[model samples]
Target: MALSLCCAWISILLLLLPSLSHGGKLLVVPMVGSHWLSMQEVVEKLSERGHEVVVLVPEVSWQMETTQAYKVVTHPVSQTLEELDNSFQEYVAVHLTQKPFPLNALAMYNTSVHVFNSFFGQCKDLFRSQETLRFLNQSGFDALLTDPAFMCGTILAHHLSLPFVFFMRGFPCNLHFAAPQCSSPLSYVPRLFSFNSDHMTFFQRVENTLISLLELDYCNGFYGEALKLSSEVLQRDVSLMDLVNSAAIWILRFDFVFEYVRPVMPNMVFVGGINCAKKKPLPKEIAPSLLNCGHAISLHNVCELEGWDFSFLFQISLMLFDRLMESPLNLINKAKNNILNKNIRIKLYLRHSITSGPRRVGAGLRFKRQILAGSTI
Candidate 1:
């Protein structure tokens, strides 16, 4: 009876499999940045998996060409990303050389606003373009995947009347998104630009609070301009905050271990180190050393020693034990199993496995110290 029931269950699952796949026409609009490169990887992967991926990108000089993997549609952007990049580099160089200890909050705020304002202006032009309008309505896209770097994608998704998923590179700590949607408390979870650790002193908390307030002020002022401009372009009334709050899902590209200990809602999912290659060929320089070394030592994200310059025998590999976010509930469940159970199926690859045994010192002590020292307070 048990054997027959198992066979019957398998038959039922096989019969219902066609209704399970969630692949469809996905429209992606990513802001240009090194951080936004992860979205490109996602678009390629989605296209490989039989989903029709369409990207509407800024027609910048440095932008990649449209290929067979995905369809690319470009619109003329007013501002150049080169100028923004140079300005950011100049800001970093000045701050890093002159005053590295206490971060200049004003300079950071000004730089961010300057960059975002330019990008937002370009997005405004893109939306106003007739070509962009034709695509948005006629594309027959099933879902929207966008990077909320400047919230232009958010506005576009809302205007198009589509369910959108935010592809955030990391948690931005925006009060509009994190506080209201995720219930991320300001008391513990520090704002992105605040430069404070999760564990904070009394005064640090006060600083965090002040930073959050200033950010709110800046966002309100800046988004007011965006609201008026967007309203004019779309020929309709809309609330920016309301659209921001309506995000169906938020995909954060960081692990819980790296983040502060805080509550994250079900909609907020973390997929850390997903961009890392599954199987990377060993570098020729390092490959020879690994063979000669009697005992193979595996390091985690430690590329260079603090004081040593010599070629080291240590091989680094980043491994994380966490749930990855994916569409289609059944696929996500199966993928999670594959991730966790891979070690069992792959034997020879386990030769480089770091010991699972308990260490003499506390786990992740070095990482903790580094994080603590790096933070403002």
Candidate 2:
């Protein structure tokens, strides 16, 4: 009887183990902007695994009700959506017109700081609220998962004395924050606003260095105002940058294949392509062209081309060969010989929006042609 009772107790404990291990309240604070679906999925997955999640959002797109899994706490701000739209438009306009005038670096930095200042300032009530602060302090959250794009979340985590983790839902541009300060070499890695590729000419490297300096300047320009606001809310002087640097881990939404090769810190992790789904079958119209195609080249990161253009190129291999004639001209010459013998096999895989298609083709024509044109075979 004693042995049987002990076995039954063991079985009961096995069933209870999962719930006990995962029973912790998690708090997620995302940047107040569009395209937050990635973070929402993270919250949902945690809730599904028996962890209670509480997400503080600027706007509640769905009805908020307490369930066994999660809850939503909404704090709507006063700024209209129109104001957000206008600010983004102004930023774009400044970037487009920056090329003609000299001293564009200073011009762009001033514009960028102004834009983010207005946007982040609008959320002061959400971050600096006495009521919100009190609620968060008493909520017994285990840890915080937040985006570092806006430093308010970092400030809140510091105020609440909670360890913070980063979940960057967009491109990973803030490598300087993740790595040791000034560790990321400005010689090759492009700035967020700079449209240059990882490979750079000597002059391009100099331009990239200048752009990076401006980015650092713009990011730190509004620190005084941010520090003042956060200190008043926390009831103590806090170093916001220090709080950000103390992150337990940073999850980036990028793939190594798409990014330039660079050293990353141990605390930094990549969970890229989290949103990608299984590929569907190609449509009937496009299927035939690729069926018996010879060697194909996939250009990664070219601008979007019309679907019809792809089909047309595949239909006539000769026309496709024509496209390669300008750059990689030797490839075209080789391709002509292969076509005559009916055994051409070249496959090109183009990556997504690295730059404009024309510029890529133009650059290729300039460089690859000269080198290959001199080759004997």
Full-model lDDT for every candidate: 0.61, 0.59
Q: Which 10-residue span in candidate 2 carries the lowest summed lDDT?
A: 332-341
Best by lDDT: 1
Alpha-carbon TM-score of each model against the true structure: 0.67, 0.62
Query: What tens digits encode model 1's per-residue C-alpha lDDT throughout 222-340?
Result: 56656776677568885656657788888877666655566677888787766552444556765566545443334333333343221121122211111111111121111111111
Model 1: per-residue Cα lDDT at residue 198: 78
Error of 2 at 304 (Å): 19
TM-score of 1: 0.67
List candidate 1 segments past 4 Å from native: 1-22, 61-65, 94-103, 170-173, 176-180, 221-225, 234-240, 278-377
